[model samples]
Structure formats: C-alpha cells, structure tokens
Target: MTQSYKIVIPVFFIGFLAGAGFWYLFSPALFDRVVSEELPAGFDLSELRSGEFRDVDGAHRGSGKAQVLVSPAGAALLRFTDFEVTNGPDLEVWLVKDPDPQKSADVSASQWLSLGPLRGNKGDQTYVIPEGTNPSEWGSAVIWCEQFGVLFSVATLSEAKI
Candidate 1:
C-alpha cells in the first residue's frame, strides 16, 4: 500500500476508537422497555406507591413516574414509566430513607437500599426489589451515580390512589 494510505488508515482507526470511548462515557443509553414478569401463584399486585422524578440540578435532567408495589408475600417491585434521565457511569437505583434529599450528600448520609443498576437512561423498565427488602420503609427513589457520588435525579414517593 502507498505510505499515504497507511497513514490515513491508522488515523481513521484511532479516530474511530476515540469516538467510541467518548460515546461510551457520555452518551445516554436508551431502549424502550416492555415488562412481563410472572408473579407467584395467588400474588397480589395491589398496594402501590408512586412518585415523580425531578432533576438534581441545572445540568442533570429527568422526567418520569416511579411506581413501587409490594407483593402480598413481601417482595417489592419498582417500575418506571415514561422515564428519562441523564445518563452517567455506574448509575444505580436506590431507595433512600429521606423523603426529599436536597442534595447529593443527603442521599449518602441517609439510610438507603440498592435496587439495582439502572437498565437504561430512557425507558419503561421494571426492577425487582429483592426479597425481604421492604420498599415502604423509605420515601424516596434515587438515580445515583455510584462511581462519582452524584445524584442524577430523585423521586419523593407518595401513595397511589387505588
């Protein structure tokens, strides 16, 4: 191959790698979700609580409703509908004791339970709250950055009218 062609090929490969890395770190992950988890025999799906998400600050943005339900046998479920949030590395869903955490620090200092890693930045997703973890004990649901200690968004939960 010509020397010019060799140089151009290497440059193109490097550029592609850099672009992929940047997208991985900064771009949001999005996939519209549809849930269909089977409940145990005679499972009750009543007893639901829900909350609306709010931005953590000016740069961070989120809009959605978080719905929490406790099965009769004590398993909990967290579902997000029409949900969207700023994407970041190591994001995790949390249930915090504080009804309203004014800042990121408040979340770390308060009691919390990890539901799981965020499935997507924008989607309708459902996460199974581990068995024996009572979601009703806390009043807030959080989108937290585990790696950076950042609060992306939060939802202060309230009982959903039957």
Candidate 2:
C-alpha cells in the first residue's frame, strides 16, 4: 500500500468507530425524550408496559390507533406504538394524564396530561418523560385522531412504580 493510503485508512476507521459509539450512547434516550414532550398531560409513565392497545372510533375511518410502554426509571425508555389511517386519513396520539371523559362524546376533544404525538407506526418509536414530572400524578392516556375526529385512550394507575 502507498504511504499516504496507510494513514488515510486508519483515520477513516477511527472516525467510523467514534460515530458509532456516540449514537449508541445517546440515540435511545434522546428519541424517547422527544416523543414524551409531545404527549398530553396526566398520563402516567410508570404504568407503561408492552402489549397495551388503544382503539379510536371507527365512524371516522380517518382516525388512528396508539399504545404505550413505560421503561424503568432514570432510563427514560418509553415506547409508543401507533397505527395511521391508511384507508382514510392520518391520526395523532398523545400521552395525557386524566383527560376529560366528556370529550369523547364527539365534536370536541379531551384535555389530557399531554405527552405528545404518536407520529408513526408501531415498534419504531420511543420517547423520554422528563424528570420532575412525577409519574405518580399520571392518571390515563388520551389518543385523538384528527382526521377521524375520535378520542381513544387507556386509564392507568396513579401511583404505579415503573
């Protein structure tokens, strides 16, 4: 190999390794935080677990579906699963606390704790609930499908520990 080629090759390999390490350390938590900020208020983060499902109204076929999973504390590992309306219109899911039950009556939407939106499909998204927002105050989660005009949600334990 040429003398110049030897130096270039090592530098390139080192840069690649460094980039990989950085992503490994920050990607999971960073992604989680972004998703959490989008959720509505009143939704508890500790009670979140795998395999939960939230269904919206079918009348408004344009609406969507969503779910949540709360990871161990300090890890900020919250997973959200959602299904967009393929046959009709898209929907947005939020992680709220104790939302108004009357909002599900149609026309108007509920007021949740507000975690944020479940932007995409299932299994690919994660969010981080910021510190100081005591998970103890979380009551339930609300999912509002903008296109279908429906509110789907799940009620959770107020003091459930992650």
Candidate 3:
C-alpha cells in the first residue's frame, strides 16, 4: 500500500477505537439519565401492573414507556416487568426513599440503574432493592428518559408487603 494510505488506515482505526471506548465508559449511565427525563405525561405507575406502559403520542422528544412498582409506603421491590422503550435513546431507573413525601430534604440517596437505546423491541430488566433500604420509608421510584428529559415517578401509600 502507498505510505499515505497506510497512515490513513491507522488513523481511522484509532478514531474508531477511541469512540467505542468513550461510549463504553459513559453511554450506559448517560443514556439512562436522558431517557429518564423523557417519560411521557399522564403515564401512570399504577397501570404498570397490567404489563404495558405507553407514552403519550408526540409529547416527548422520543418514543418510549416505563412501569414501576413499590411498597405501600413507596419502597421499590420489583422494577422491570412492566418496562419497555422504543424509538428512543437510553433510559435510567432510580429508587428513592423519602420519609417525608412533601419535602425533598428527607429523601434518601438514590440508586441508579441503566437500560437501553431500544430502537426496536428492547426487553425488560428488573431490580431488587438491597437489604439495607427500608421498604416502609420508600416514598417514590422514578424512571427517567435521558435524551428527552422526562421523569415518571410512582409513590407508594404504605410500606410494601414484600
């Protein structure tokens, strides 16, 4: 090969590697956050038990849906059976426990989980809370669409039985 051609090949390869590496390191969490914010308006958490959550048409930047379940007091026990995202960027799911539902100051730290870019028919992924998190204190669980900046939150009325 010509000298210039050899140099061009190596440069292209290096660029590809760099891009892939960057995505690998940051894409999951970043995409999740973006999708978390893009959740649709009037999307109900209670409906998730039925196994399908649909977003309002054209309300958000992208098209996607999410479901959430929590203890009566709002602790998240299982998240994922009712989840789906399509035609959008990635989504992030978080579990937040707050003793005082009206105030943000009483909220416990949040746990971040990642989902998908989901161009077509992406599957669901479930999350189980750790033992340290008290089920009764859980006030809300949120699913965020990172790209469109939407947040879908479900609040529990009492402590979860499980």
Candidate 4:
C-alpha cells in the first residue's frame, strides 16, 4: 500500500527465485533419492558372495553392502543393501577389472562390463550381470557417470565367509 512497500516486495521475490535456481543447478549431486524393489520370493541370500562399497577419487562418499546372488535356476544378480551415495547425472553401475579407479580413463583402460544404469543414487538396488559373463573375474564395482566421465564410488569384491 505504501510507495516503498510495493517496490521492496517485488525485489525480494525476484531474489528468492534467483537463489532457488542457482541452488538447483549447482548442487545436483547433493540431492538424495531412495528407491525400493522387491526381490524374488525364491531368491536365496545364502549363496551370495559379498563385498563392501568404498569411496574413490575423493569426489564420492557413502558406503553399503554389495552381494552377488544367484537364483535357484542359475541367474546372477548384483544386490546393494543399506546403500547410500551422492547423486549424479548419467550414473551407471559398472563391474571393472581395476579395484580402484581414479578417473574415467581407468574405466576403459582395462576390461569393463556394465551391470547397467544405476537404479538409484541412494538405497537398495539390484543389477543382473550378463548370464555368460563371470562375476569373479572383475575385482571391483564402480558407480560411474557416463556423461561427465566421473567415478562416483567403488566397491572391491571379495568372497564372503558364509
């Protein structure tokens, strides 16, 4: 109603909008997403070979349990539980020969097989490794960003003493 009040309100609204836009664009990886999927009723966890996720390149954080489980009929799956990690665009799950990769070049520097595009940046997920490919041959698992060539995280695979 006052002359100064009208001008001040518009200026404040514009500033708020600008700040929100900047936050959304610049801090994409900070967002957290949780997704859930049901496992097959007959799937057995007893036969799984398990591993623990680790951070790499000082650009990633968070940890979780990784397991390679086989179905009763003989299909292989990579499962992640209690999983947490930073979010990034074009992130794909990769099984790699190198246990610790510092950059994108290292991803292709040796033999690598993609489990598939990452299901979610945070929470439990599963991936099916191609039937003929041997999971034992790969040393570790990597959450890689295909578009920007960034390694989000890595997990070294090892046999679990079940």
Candidate 5:
C-alpha cells in the first residue's frame, strides 16, 4: 500500500471508534413504547387524584399529567398520561416527598421512592406503587436521570376538585 493510503486507513479507524464512543455516552435509549398496560380487571378508574408536571432544572424539560388511582381492592397505581419529555439516559420515575426541588442538589437531599426506570420519553405509562408504600406522602412526581444526577421534570400532586 502507498504511504498515504496507510495513514488514511488508521485515521479512519480512529475516527470510527471516537464516533461510536460519543454515541454510546450521549444517545438516549431508543424505545418504541405503545399499548398501555391493562389495569387489573376489577380496578376502578373513576376516583383518581391528578396533577400536572412542571419543568425542574434545565435538564428536566417536558409537560405531562400524572394520576394516582385507587382500585376497588385498595391497590394504588401511579400513571402518567399525555406525557412527553426530552430523552435522557438512565431516567427513572420518582415520587418525591419534597414539594419543590429545583436542581440536582435539592433532589439529592430529598426522600424519594423509585418507581423504576422510565418506560419511554413520551406517551402514557403506569407504575404500581409497591404494596404498602403510601403515595400520599409524596408531593410530586419526578423524572430523574439516575446516571447523571439530573432532575428532568417534576409534577406537583394535588387532589382534583371533583
């Protein structure tokens, strides 16, 4: 091979590796989420407490609706409906006891329950608060990026006047 060709080959390989590394570090998880999970057959949706999500920190950017539903059997479920937020890495759904947390530092000091990694960046989803965990104690629903300690968004919980 010519000297010029040899140098070009090595440079191309290095460029490829660097591109892959950056993609892995910053690209959001690609999830094609459709079809809402079915609530138990006897679950009642008539009585639900709802809230509206707000942006927290520059990292958390999205608007959505949150709902706390009690089934006829007394099981509590948290559902996010009409939700859309910016994609993030290692995101989680958290029910926070703090009424207002503006940044990562504020979130680090607060008590929270992990509902699990977020299902998707957009659309409707549901999470079952483990048996015996009181949703009432939490004042907001938070989209948290666990890997980067970023709070993506927060929704203040309030009883819907029926």
Candidate 6:
C-alpha cells in the first residue's frame, strides 16, 4: 500500500463517523413514543383548556391537540394527544402568556414557563404542571426547539366547558 493511501483511508473513516453522529443528532428523523400517564389513582382528568397545534413554518410543523387538564383537587397536567412535531436536537414544552404566538420571539417576549423537555416528538405524552402554576394564565402551549431557538408549533388554548 502507498503511504498516502494509509492516511487517506483513516481520514475517510473518521469523516464518515463524524457525519453519522451529526446526522443522528440534528437530522429530521421521525420517532414515536406513546406514554399513558397515570394520575394519583382515584381521580379523573378533566380538560380545563385545550388547543389545536399549528405549524410555525414548513420545516417545523406540528399537528395535534394540546390539552391542559386538571383534577377536582386542582392538580394540573399538560397533555399532548395525537401529537407530532418536527424532531429537533432539544425540544421543550412551554406555556407562554401570548394568546397567539406565531414566532419564536413571542415565546421569549411573553411571560412563560417551561414544562420541561418534550418527551417525544410524536405520540401521546404528559407533563406535570408545576404546583400552583395557573394554566389559565398562559394562553399558548408551544413546542419549542431550545437548541436552535425555533418555534415548532403553538396551540392557543381556549377555555373548555368540560
């Protein structure tokens, strides 16, 4: 083997490995995770407010329902049903004060609380709203990409009778 071939072969392999890792982290790969969140046992969940998700842009579209649920005792939960969003490196669930958030700036400009990292990009999942946090005060439930500062989806919550 030539001296140049030895160096070229190793360099090529290293580049391939690096590219694979980047793709795995940053690519728009689709994955689904369904979670059936159980409450404290005896109580039933009632929808307080709910909204249908709207895509922020073509690349970061989402479609589903985001429901803010509460129990009889005032325990609150945020749930996403029939949910799917564009997968990203780091996505978070945020309750923002904006009634209608169309851009990423709306999230940062308004009063907001982060529920936490989104459990899954596609599927049914639940996030526990922090104790004493009033879900009613927040108007939008957003799927935000923290790493890139992008808004994937926003749902403008409306009061529900049931």
Best by TM-score: 6
Encode model 4's per-residue lDDT on 33-142: one tens digit a residue.
78876666766655456678877646676599888877666688888888877787777898998866666688769678887888787888888889887777787788
List, residue by residue over 39-154, the lDDT tens digit for candidate 1. 34565776578999999898777899888977766777888888888877888999999999978999989999988888778777777888877777788999999988999899
TM-score (C-alpha, index-matched) for candidate 3: 0.35
lDDT of 3 by residue, 1-162 (tens): 699999999999999999997886556544442212233334343322212243423432222233344444444434443344433334454445532222222232343333323322234444555645544444444445565555433333333233
Give per-residue CA lDDT, model 6, range 33-107, as digits (tens). 445554456768899999999989888889999999899889999988888887887889999999998898878
In model 2, the Cα lDDT at residue 131 comes to 62
Which stretch of 10 consecutive residues in model 2 shows the poorest summed lDDT? Answer: 59-68
Query: Total clashing residue pairs per candidate?
Result: 0, 25, 23, 0, 1, 0
Q: In model 1, what is the error at residue 90, expressed in angstroms?
A: 1.2
| Ranking, lDDT, top scorer first | 6, 1, 5, 4, 2, 3
Please give the CA lDDT of all the candidate structures: 0.83, 0.44, 0.41, 0.78, 0.80, 0.87
- In model 2, the Cα lDDT at residue 92 comes to 47
Candidate 5, residue 157: CA error in Å? 0.8
Candidate structures ordered by TM-score, highest first:
6, 5, 4, 1, 2, 3
lDDT of 5 by residue, 1-162 (tens): 699999999999999999997887667744434436555675566435678888765655878888888775668888888888777778899988887777777778999899998888888888988898776788888889898888888888877678
Model 3 score (lDDT): 0.41
The best candidate by lDDT is: 6
Q: Which stretches of candidate 6 lie over 4 Å from their true place?
A: 1-21, 28-30, 34-41
TM-score of each: 0.75, 0.41, 0.35, 0.76, 0.82, 0.83
Model 6 TM-score, 2 decimals? 0.83
* Model with the higher lDDT, candidate 1 or 6: 6
